[model samples]
Target: MSVTAVIRKNSYFDSVSLMSISTKANGIDGVDQAFVAMATEMNKAVLENLGLLSDELKAATTSDLMIVVVPSEGADGDELVPLVEELLVRKAPAAGSAEVSHRTIASALEEDADINLAVIAVNGAFAAREARKALDAGLNVMMFSDNVAVEDEIALKNLAHDNGLLMMGPDCGTAILNGVALCFGNAVRPGTVGIVAASGTGSQEVSVQVHALGGGVSQLIGTGGRDLSAEVGGVMMIDGIRALAADPGTEVIVLVSKPPAAETEAKVLAEVANAGKPVVVYFIGGSRDAVLAAGGHFAASSADAARQAVELSSAAASAPETLDAGQVDAVLARLTPEQVNVRGLFCGGTLCDESMYALLNDGHEVFSNIQKNPAFQIGAADSSRGHTFLDFGDDEFTNGRPHPMIDPSNRLARIVEEAKDPSVAALVMDFVLGFGAHEDPAGVTLPAIREAQRIAQEDGRHLEIIAYVLGTELDTPGLDAQRKALAGAGVTVTSSSTVTGEFARAIARKGAAA
Candidate 1:
């Protein structure tokens, strides 16, 4: 393989644009890997890590756009440069366009005094500076940039609090304000359920499930992943809960997170206790008694949270059509004696965690790269243990690449790999749909599912593919179409990740018995 680098001086593109360009480049016929980003220090470090850095790239300024492409063997590296340039040009607007984009937050506010929120996704080193400027201009902040220091996050949140404003994230990925879906959010119908979440996909899962169950969301606030940590003190979570409580449009409040520090949890529960509105809590590893004791209801998963919130809001809940015991047994009965394990490949970290928790609670010895249970941790990320689950969106897999949400290539390859293992009884997966996600996630993954099924059949084995789509009908790449595609591929598409997990566990349990 050959690596080629191109530097465009004085060129600028936003984070979303760069990610799009990179995804486009990687899709080229002969390209093995591609990275399109500004020459910021953090991006340069990423390039170095990917072994795509060059002397010329190192000399490029932060204002320059750097494009790197690695060609597969026997592919002409030089030929791919034009393709990258063409893709960038197609993705970006003309340089001479009359519609001008603002260079600073102050200018943007000056142009539109009604602008209430600033979505910042710059390099981590400069993310805090831009966020401060936005806050100073009296704008709420939704930070989509990662790599920011914890200290900076605390300072930003404190400043936002002092000004009576909401700071969604320093690494926040999902939120819905008023009716606009911001940064990595899905399009759900607007209604009475408002959410405050420290997990991105966790909130998306809940909001989508609510929409699917004939309920809708009024607002969804993201508190980033660290907001619930001891140092950050769940500042944003408490503030979000309070804001949603005060909004007349919101009737039921839901809080979602993986697990918070003990002290932080107590403070958050205290705020939830007096929110007046009915509250549902889904702290992944949290205690149910704690929520009940705090005058709030506890939900076991995102799906459960949505059901409880919809019920509290007086919306009719669409009963989930899960696999019954006999159906599960019938499916498991078809599995050969050698097929005794379930493999889950997930794009959302929280979904992976929930699946692991469900399987473990079902008395299955689940192993995962993101497992909180050390005893069940995978020996290596690339190696699958008994009933293994892998989070493809983990930093290790996305160090210099677009997230799996943007590109399902890695996950697709792993699905095929798992299918080759005769011991694998079931393959469970999740497809997340929303803004900033792949336009045709189901279409992109359907080919792999077909190939996996083909391989399993060739080996005289049956591979049951179970999938759950986290999205609403309103999201682009409509949820109904995605589900239909998966089902057409001979895969059992469930209504939610929670239901998918339960079904997979049942199949695995019966497989073990067989």
Candidate 2:
């Protein structure tokens, strides 16, 4: 009998098991055997893990294309009828290898992304296949596309390691590598600080802190959102650190995340202890007890970690230094009345809010997560004339699509446009790149600064572009290159987002020198 399979619309799965295909009276063939085996494996929850389907409850809902897995040649018309019932959609294409299905999706995107960065969105077979292709191309791949087979992730990451590359997530939400902003928001400077984080937001906070201390990142690697799970293990984490240790540019290491299984934590910390660099560690809400036993220094707060990373990155001959809130207050106290409008643009959702939250005293107002959320997908403004904290995720610049990490056109353009605004004196930004981020962010970034300079010079307006970048990740497109690019632009680059905030505050209340 000829069997039919339906492909669902809006589906992100490109790896559908094609099963078998033949005519009637012939019985099962290779395609049939393969399809049946794939179906029998029965791990629908993988959809959720891969970020293909955000929820697990609906993994089995298939519909768009009608695929017929015929048993063999000829067969029976009666069997064909039964199998045909599974078919749907008049626009179906003939079923073939999974590779062909992926190309179909790619053709759809080619019109938009073409061969360049404007490519908008791709779901289903295309996003998956191209995601794999991107990994093969050695780009820092951060897939919100979840539930990928563990084996696939291992293979992807192993291949990346072999090529001296890094892969942040099969479910990685944030990464800052080579001073290029990816999926997350942060305002870090180009400095000696390096980070390998398991939590997306944790690295964001740390990098911001580093920038605040007049420091920056060499690279910031994200190892999926959960690297310490007994099931997920720390394979990527191990590969990431091993790569970082070999990097000549990274002088200091910072590890940040939530606590993991005791064994997993031990495995990660043991490596940190032996990394031969001063490691500043923060596993949020983790037992201080575990850190004490780690034999490495523990940071009680993100701010402390940032300060230490800066001190260590700078080749300080002593313990890291500190700039108290009082010192910060003192810096702010000198600001004149005209410079109260500090504008911050970031990619990390949590870091954006944290900066807003920190700066939000009496008169200060903030706008967190400004870009990705549907409400502000286009643009937004805070009626308040106070300080503003905005998030322009790699995704929010939907000139065509999301993924600010991979494409810098929108943010870079915004940098030039926003510089022209009358009220925008101090501009705050974050640069994150990794195995999962854009290939060479600095290549796209420097020109924007040059243009912003042209506009600033044209108007004779004193514009300050303050930024923090995270570049210390285990990848071939090293973060150091991006960091240096930003520095060469003569912009104020730091390592921590909070310090970037402070720098913005100084610029907003002060002027171009900040």
Candidate 3:
């Protein structure tokens, strides 16, 4: 193996561009791994962890762009430097067509004082500082960067609250304000349903469902994932509820989160009860009765939340589509006796949690890398036992690489591994579509899905690949086309994660009984 590093002096690219370049380089033949990033301290640490850092890279300043590549045995490593340069050139904006760019919050504000929101996507260590500048300039914040200190988040939120402004997140990924999608958001029609979610994909899933149900969204607010915890006190949740309640365009408000602390849940429920507008709450593992008792509708899943929200706002309802009993039976009958367990590899953490709960509710002994119960937690992320569900988008899997949403390479590799296991009965996954997500996610994974199926078939085993695509028809990578691509690959594609999980559970139960 060989390692190479190049530092571009005084050159800078956004994190997303660097991540895309790194992902592209890592996918190159004979390349073991790659790191393309600004020389920020956080990124430097990532390079060190990957063992790709060099003395030159260590001395590089944050203004420098660093490209490090590791080549596997027998690989022509010399091509790496030229390849990195080529990718950078291709990714850069055209010389004469470049739009105006801002180097600081003050300068951006100077250019457009009407700018109401600032979306921060810098390194975590510098995120808070930039966010504070934005807040000081009277701008609402949508922080797309993670790894921010909790104390900084608390301080920023409190400051926003004091100024009667919104501070969305330090790790928030998706939000739609008025009618504009921001940072990792989807394009949906403007309507009466409004959402405030703590999970990125959760917001997308519910909003897309609302669109499909003939309803539109007025606003979508993301409070980051930690807003509902005891430490954060659900500050943004209550504020978002209040804001939407007062917005004349929003007839119904929906709240989504994985689960909240007891005190935080109670506080949010109190706000929901008092809000003049009807509320739909979908706390993935929270008590449904609690929401009802608080004068709100409780949804069983993200799709259900959107359905109920639409029903309340416009008296429209869309029945969830799921596989019939016969379809389930046929899939089970085709599986070999050795294929008895279900393997769920997901890019959405909330979806994975919801799937695990759905399987447990259906009386399956499921394990997951993200499960809170040690008994049900997989001992190793790379290994699966029993009916296992893994979140490839988790921080543990994304430490040095781009998120699975932006780069599906890791999940694709895992899919192949799961298919090779004789005990794997089914492979269930999610494909997220949006502005910052992969352009052609399903197209990229189609080959891997075919290969996995072929590997299973060659061993005289059957593999059931069930998936759900989360996005609206209006997204760049059209939802319909993505689903069509998956379906064309002989994969069962659904519209909801809940339905997908239920289908996988049904197959697993039937296979076990067989």
Candidate 4:
């Protein structure tokens, strides 16, 4: 086996486009594994873990792009670096498309009077400035960049509110506007249910569940994850609630997020009380009584929220599906006496939080990087003690890298790492599908999954893998195909995020007894 590393000085590419390059490089023949990313400290550590960090790359800066490829035995690794670099070359513009380029937001708006929204995905330092420009131009803004200062976020959101323009996020990842899915959002039918969420994957799971329940969404607005924090004060949340309340097409509303600050929750619930339409609320670890007193229904999970919204919207929903007991028993039957913990490697933060909450509620001690209690926090990124659920999309993992949804390299590495642990009984995860997600998430992650199972079998233990795909039949890599692929790999693919958590809990409970 041979490893090759190449670096391009001062080269830069957005996370989304770089994902494409990484995907293409891995598909090349003779390649065993590929790592293509900017040489940030975190990325260098990842490369070091993969045994691909060369001496020259160790000195590379964040502005430098690094490509590392490991070639299979007998294959020439030296010849692969140039080929990988070729993937970075931008494709030529199609005929007549060259004239459409705009130098700034003002230029674009001046040229196209119909442009009403600007999607900002620059570095966090420059994100606020661009968002401010869009707001000044009377355009609604959806900022996808993270790492912006809290003060800048508050100022931008306040300006947007004062101008009567919608400000979606400083780190917002998903939204569905006018039947069009935007930035990591799933494809779903357009109908009466409207959603306002401070969680990206949380909103996604609810919207997909609503679609599965025979109801549809009119609009799914995202108010960046920090909207409900005390500092930000739920600016976009209140604005989103008002927008959906007055929307004629919306008859039922759903609000999803982790619990907000006490004052913020009260303000949001007060708004819900006067929505003049049925509302379903699902806030992780939040107060159900507060929702009930505010005249809104409280949902126990994402699936429950969708069911309530469907019923409130008067949609002809189908009966909810039940998990197969036989399948659960079959998995638990194979676990060894020493195997007892569930290690969830998740791409979606909300999905991770939901599963952790489910395990904790069932008397299982779940340790995670997102843990609220200091007692349950994992010691390190690679550490998994008891039941550990790690959200790979957390800032520590994604600070200067692409989210795991778009690039599964980090998660793929962690899968093998976790499998080497003797106490790990089951692996729980999520495959997010839709517009900005990977083209085929299951297809890309299958090799790692197979390798993990191989390691467990060699150790004479069974590794139960449970997964939930958050998407619909309408998504690019449709739900049915992704689930089918995983099921073929002997994975237990649950019907919903809630079911996925339940399945993991069942394994954890049985493993504990073993």
TM-score of each: 0.94, 0.44, 0.94, 0.90
- Taking the tens digit of each residue's C-alpha lDDT, what string does model 4 give over 100-154? 7666898897789899999988656578998999998899999887778899999
Per-residue lDDT for 318-369 in model 2, tens only?
3333324564455455444334456666655445544554454323444444
- On the 0 to 100 scale, the lDDT of residue 190 in model 3 is 88
1 against 3, candidate with superior lDDT: 1
- Cα error, residue 169 of model 4, in Å, equals 1.2
lDDT of 1: 0.88
The ten-residue window of minimal lDDT in model 3 covers: 315-324
Model 4 TM-score relative to the real fold: 0.90
Residues 191-246 of candidate 1 have per-residue lDDT tens digits of 99999999999999999888888998999999999999999999999999999999
Higher-scoring candidate on TM-score, 3 or 4: 3
lDDT of 3 by residue, 266-326 (tens): 9999998789989999998889889999999999987789888988997466665655777
* Clashing pairs counted in every model: 0, 85, 0, 0
Q: Give lDDT per model, in order.
A: 0.88, 0.55, 0.86, 0.88
Error of 1 at 354 (Å): 1.2
* Candidate 3 displacement at residue 13 in angstroms: 3.9
